[model samples]
Target: MAARTAPAQPAPAQPAPIASAVRRDTADAARWPDVARLPAAQPVRTAIARHLVGRALHRLSLLEPDGAPAGATAGPVLTLHDPQAFYLRIARHGLTGFGESYMAGEWDSNDLPGALTVLAAHADTLVPAPLRRLRPLWAAARPGQDRNTPQGARRNIHRHYDLSNDLFAAFLDPTLTYSSALFTAFPARFDSLAQAQHRKIDRLLDLARVEEGTRLLEIGTGWGELALRAAARGATVTTVTLSAEQADLARNRIRAAGLADRVEVQLRDYREVRGRYDAVVSVEMIEAVGCEYWPDYFTALRRALAPGGRIALQAITMGHQQMLNTASTHTFISKYIFPGGLIPSRRAITEHADAAGLRTTADDGYAEHYAETLRLWRQRFTTNKDAVTALGFDPVFQRMWEFYLAYCEAGFRSRYLDVRQLLLTEGTRR
Candidate 1:
């Protein structure tokens, strides 16, 4: 036996063709990176991306969907449903793609606010050092037609506020106040939203020193709710708005409330508003005034304000750095929800006001209240989803609305954004 020739090893069992196919499939599945799209960019960029995201998450102690971070007390849990697609989109479009990914349902969170808080905490670090230099190239410019010109203002307001009264009513409280509610009661009940809204209005009126014989000018008559409230205080009120639908309904509501004698609603632009007033109050309206037109808006308001009168403005604001970074960018919110809208930072407000010969006398931030208010609105909208669809809004539109509410809620929750009641007087007051 020639050294006992090794028994012909049975041709090592050739994997069955079907088995080979199954094995190949398993290998292909395993080849997908734990985080998708990680290799979409240059090696350096890819490493930077991974490091930035990983470091931020770990710092926040936020868990990945299957309970990550081994022993850390986790915050929000992020689920990357299609990590590859999500990362690829982010690589291509940057921040806008981040929003697009959410819209596309490529990612999700167990607690949206918690997730946003984590992001907010690390906002400065989220953009890798190398990519930070390219932000200008990545950002989309504000559209020319999306200006807050008298014509553009009308177009933008009509796009959102003119959708339909019934549609808004389905979600808003009966007061029809579209701005942030005061929500004196934390964890507010549905019924409390109206009371809270009224409280918010009254507080502004009080701040403006509205009283009997006062001449009140309101910019942005939101369905006439604020005007009605002001008029009820015995002040003669003149309110203006660019939305035809809001004007029509607001006028009717004024008549129905039997306060038409005290209040006048006009479909007019702030730039065209002409009367002087003892008090001026604009609630959540200044956000529509593009950064370029803020000076004009404040000048007009200043012109309309009488000697010794005060202006009470309810505004939504973001971090100063965020405002600076985003001022020139046309964002998802501006594109879909409010075509020409730009939320002013407190710094922008004060600067513009000072430029217009006004000074901020008092400022109060109620960002947490706004978060609760949005939660209530979102709840109502979800409850009335069927009614919303019946009003001719398609699924995408509804989802967009839902996302809008949730996004704002998250912003406020994270303290990355806020709503403030600001009291302003002539610069001489300072």
Candidate 2:
């Protein structure tokens, strides 16, 4: 969104230093240490995890220590340099720990997205029935303080969005847009990304019917890309964002685009928005509004919407069951990347909208495009590693971003994740 094989396979006869390679002791990188420096799992638990992981290698090969294959496999090869640490990490924290192991240099794959797609395809079957029954005892719930209260929301936004504009600039296109771009074609050339981003933004504006003299409101202004485009279409935009860094950069970008009078970038929360808007648009910000706050979020949108106004949103989606499964559980994304983010399902989106007096008028799903988008981003990110490092991000941070991008790409490729553009208007059922 985000490798090393630095750890060695310790001899069984000697004690193991499982946490040695995984520790983020860099003084410069203190901001993003690994989530909850994991303790080693009990031997029996480690053995059971090792058994399950080995059993789950249907679509990929797991290369254990000494270059031995975990099983007969046919897809990407996951090479494990520190098999003990990797297995024990999975044993301790399951999926979160698996991601931590990767961030810590425990395992790696030449084709990370391919490997991750394999895992995503087998996610349901990875843990056997008996072990699945025991998940409640082993799984950890999300931390309470990570809730999405007005104050808590700002803290969550800052953790990820405030990382650095320079850091984001290293990977994103010139527009600095972070959500899925609606590509005109698949396997699109890098040169065309900015165009694709404009295409995506323009579509949302069109769905909202933004036009000359339209009073537009954009929730989650992503560096002013949408606002600039909206202003160009003669719509006056009042965009809001919680990240101070984003607000400053967005205002500067809008001013430079000569759209300052047409677009207003506010360092404000959606809850604090006042007055009514003729058109409303939000891109990928719903994910950051935790499920618990979705009602309040949609209500705020409805309150801002004037009569005959339309609302458009681009949301990353998951299966309803999957959303329920992880609603209260902590995952790798929630832990290391976004503190309180939770992607909603399409069903949840419409239900909440309807409850807030909004009716669905259009639905468009194009997750395959998102996979390509992530692929392009990861390509640029990997190419600009030196620049990223120059920005003071640690090697582990680089790998974390690598893993995140690949992981999300795999989710889309495997149909485990989805992205949609939804159009809604105030209406009652016929």
Candidate 3:
């Protein structure tokens, strides 16, 4: 009998059409060698890609090792590569990856601001098809309650500004003020952030039309700089802050400057405050109130001001045409920095103010001033990194802070974010 031929080995199974499609969809996202080396039964590459593509593309490029890109895409373009190590570093680490990736010669882009502008403009394209299905589910699961109460307010302020006074002091000007950007009517020779801040205070005073012996109230009195300036100008000042630490520091500063009698700093929520003042000024605090509370905030501001009193509000406004949660800036800010912060469009703020019986007297944009301000802060922070670290901040915390500052600078530089100063008055005033 002839020897039987060995049974032919079974042919490998071909991937189904659906599986092939899924693989193609994920082919553009980066996958770590460690992840790739895992057993074939566990496929994390697809999950990673799904997560990445579902969000907005911040920046994407293919680059050589010498900080020169082979090719670059400015808008929401998908990144597809299997970088040996450096590019993978940025993929693994989020914002912190940016500085490291740039410094390591892993990537380069000639126009970061342009790239950001394109990313922001095309952010809506990043949403995955599947995320639409989960929207209703998420909405159903989300609590109907609003978390913008007084205690919640203080907690939110503490999360961001109260991290360490020393850290802020190192970067901020001599006054230690942190608020909206400073503006000059015509560019002047003032050469410092402190001077710029002084100019901002002067502008606010001028806009508010504060008279000698007039009563002034400041909401979110960061570092008490404005309050002190107002008091120095002979206006009686009352200021409030959510941070106990800030209130303490401001109070001490006020006492030291011999203006304790003219200026008062209180650790109190804006909503809980009472009494009427000649003018009301709020800077940088509106963002923390969240858009849901805008109506209430305006109501409270209205109540706190005497009839005919002027109100000046300075804020960083989201662009008029931008959509919420597409780029999802609030998510990042809430998680790592200002937990309850929400920047609204100028239209939103003005509408709420109008609804609350306040008439807008003036609306001005200081978008460029913010870029200069942030640049100054970044320089100061970078120059004082050792002092910042000496204050007991860990590397992760430092990276987070640096990323926050630098990204803010980039955003302002790109006009993806804007700063606005609005002067308002009760119906009786104008």
TM-score of each: 0.83, 0.90, 0.74
Q: What is the lDDT of residue 221 in candidate 1?
A: 92
Q: Give the range of the ten consecutive residues with the poorest summed lDDT in model 3.
A: 13-22
Candidate 2 local lDDT, residue 185: 52
Off by over 4 Å in 1: 1-75, 189-191
Candidate-wise lDDT, in order:
0.75, 0.82, 0.63
- Per residue, candidate 1 scores C-alpha lDDT tens digits across 245-335 of 8899999999999998999888789999997899999999989888889989999999999998899999999878888888888777887
Q: List the lowest-lDDT window of 10 residues for candidate 1.
A: 13-22
**Between candidates 1 and 3, the lDDT winner:** 1
Better of 1 and 2 by TM-score: 2
The TM-score between candidate 3 and the true structure equals: 0.74
> Which candidate tops lDDT?
2
Per-residue lDDT tens digits of candidate 3, residues 96-158?
A: 333343323333334333344455445445445675444343222212232567767777788
Q: Which prediction has the highest TM-score against the true structure?
A: 2
Distance from true position, residue 328, model 3, in Å?
Answer: 8.9
